[model samples]
Target: MTSCGCLMLEKVEGDASAKTRVKAAPGAGAGAWCGSCAGDWRGRSEAIFPIYVMGSSRESTVAAARGIVDSPEDPIWVAVKAEAKSEAEKEPILSSFLYASVLSHDCLERALSFVLANRLEDPTLLATQLIDIFNDVMLNNKDICRSIRLDAQAFKDRDPACAQYSWALLYLKGYQSLQSYRIANILWNQGRKVLALALQSRISEVFAVDIHPGILSI
Candidate 1:
C-alpha cells in the first residue's frame, strides 16, 4: 500500500479470523475509515494501522499524528537510546543488536531505515544497497517518516504488550513489517514499482504477512 496523490483505500494483510475487511460506514466521507474488528484507515493507511493503531479509529490516528510525529531530532529518540543502553548493560550478548537497532541511530527515521532495509534485503537488493534507498525515503519523505512515529505511538497507545518504545522499535515484527511496507509504498509512488514489489516480497517472506497490491476498497 503506497501513497497516492489521490485518496485511496487499502486492503491490508487480512487475518484468518476476520471474515471480511471493513471500512467506515457511509457518510463519514473520505476522511475516516474505522475498522471495527481490529484496525482503522486514515492518511496513515492500514498497512501501518493494524500493527500500531490496532482497533483504533480515524480520530486516534489523527491524534497520534498530531502528538508524537516529531522530527528526526525528537527527545524520545534520546530516551529510547538510554533504554537500549540500560538493557544492553543488563544483557551484554544482545548489546550489539540493541545498539544497531536503536542506540546507534540518532533518530527514529534512521532507525527505521536500518530496520526495514535489513528486513527487506534479498539476493537482488542487498541490505547495503537497500539501506541508502530506505534512508532517503525515511529522511526525505515527511509522510512516511510521520507514519512511523504515529504507528509507534499507536502501538504504545493500543497494545498492552508494547510496554516501551524501545520494545516496539526493536522487538515487534508487525511494527517492522508495516514500516517496511511504507518504504515500499514510497518506492512504488516514485515509479520504482519493481523495487517496490521486490521489497514487498521480502516483507511477506520475512514477516509472514502479505498485502496484495490490488487490495482495493470501493
Candidate 2:
C-alpha cells in the first residue's frame, strides 16, 4: 500500500477482516500517527485518527471529517447492516441483493455508491464510471452521504409506513429520487450539464418523481 500518512487502505481481497486497515500513529490515540521510522509522517493528531485520509488531501477530507469520528463505519450504517444480516439469515430469497448491496460494502457511502451507480449505469455509461463519479462525489463531499443517511433515518423516524432501514436502503423510490437529484446537482454545478440533465431525466423516469435541475437547493 502506498503510504499517504498514518492510515493505509490495507486490503486482503478475500479476507473478511482485512477489508481496510488503519494503523494508529504513535500517540496511541484514535488519530495518532505511528512514531516509528517507517510509519512516521508529520501530521495532526485529529487528521490521522479515524479511518485515515483513506488528500493535498481534497475536499473529501473536509467533507468526511464532518460525518466520521475515529472509525470508517458510521453507527447508523452499522445498525442497518446488522438488520440486513439478520434478514439474510432468515430469508434465503433476499440474500443475493442484501449481500451484494449492503453486506458486501465496508461503509454506508460505498454501498450507496454501488447501488446508485448500477441503477444509473447503462451500455454506454459504465458502472465503473458511475461508481468512480459517485465515489468522488461522496468522498469529496460526504455531506451528500450524510444527507442521505438523514433522509433514510427520517423515514424510519417519521413515516409510519416505513419501519426498517433495509426497506429504505433497497426499495424507497422517493429516497432514491432525492439521492439521484443530489448527485446530479453536484455534476450540474461542476459544469457537467449534459450528464447532469441526463441523470435528472433518468431519475424521474425510474423513480416517477420529477425534480427540476435548475431549482436551487436550500
Candidate 3:
C-alpha cells in the first residue's frame, strides 16, 4: 500500500524467461499489500502495469503518486467519525453497526443516508432504493445538508442526554425522523408526490412521527 493506505501494484521488469514480479510502488510500506490485495502473483505475467485496489482508481493513484491529498472534510463530520470510533472501542458489540453506519462512509451525508434507509426500509421498500433517494436529495440540496448539520449540533448542544454528535446522528429517532421529513419535503416539492408520500408513511411507521411531506416546516 502507498503512504495514503491506497493499494499500489508495480510491475518488475526482468528477462523474458523470468516471471513478472508484482511489488509495491516506491515509498510503500513493508509488506505493503492490504488484506484484499494480498495474493500470489507468480506466473501471472499477463498482469502487467499497476492495478489500483480498494477506493483508489487510476486517476486517484496518479494523484496519490504526486502526493496530492483529498480536500479537507467537514469538521462536524470529522468529529462524528472520531466519536464513533471511540464509542465502538468502548462498546464492542456495536462495532459492526458503527463501522457500517459511519466508518464505512466517507462523509456525513452518505452515512446519514445509510442510517435512515436501513431504519425505514421495509419488505416492499429496499434499503438500496431508499439510499438512492436519500442520497439524491441530500447531495443536491445545500439547504438540507446545512440543516442536518445544524440539527445535529442542536442535539449535541441542547440535549443533555446526547453526549456526542454521532449519538444524535446514529441513535436519536427524532433526529432521523426530521432528516427523513426534509428529504420527503424536497421530493414533494419536486412533484414526486407518490414517492414522497411513501417515504412519509415509512417514516411514520419507523419513527412513529407522522408529518405531512407537503408542509414546509421551519
Q: Which stretches of candidate 1 lie above 4 Å from their native place?
A: 1-65, 70-73, 213-218
Candidate structures ordered by lDDT, highest first: 3, 2, 1
Cα-lDDT of candidate 3: 0.78
* Among all candidates shown, the one with the greatest TM-score: 1
lDDT of 1 by residue, 1-218 (tens): 22222323545555564232444443444553235422323434455455543444568566656656554456456667888899999999999998898887777888877877777777777888888988887789877766777677767767879887888877899888877777777777778888778777878989998774333111
CA RMSD for every model? 9.9, 17.2, 20.0
Give the clash count for model 1.
Answer: 0
TM-score of every model versus the real structure: 0.67, 0.64, 0.66
Clashing pairs in 1: none
lDDT of 1 at 138: 79
Worst 10 residues of 2 by lDDT: 37-46
Question: Against the unseen true structure, what C-alpha lDDT does each candidate score?
Answer: 0.69, 0.70, 0.78
Candidate 3 wrong stretches, greater than 4 Å:
1-72
Q: In lDDT terms, how accurate is model 2?
A: 0.70
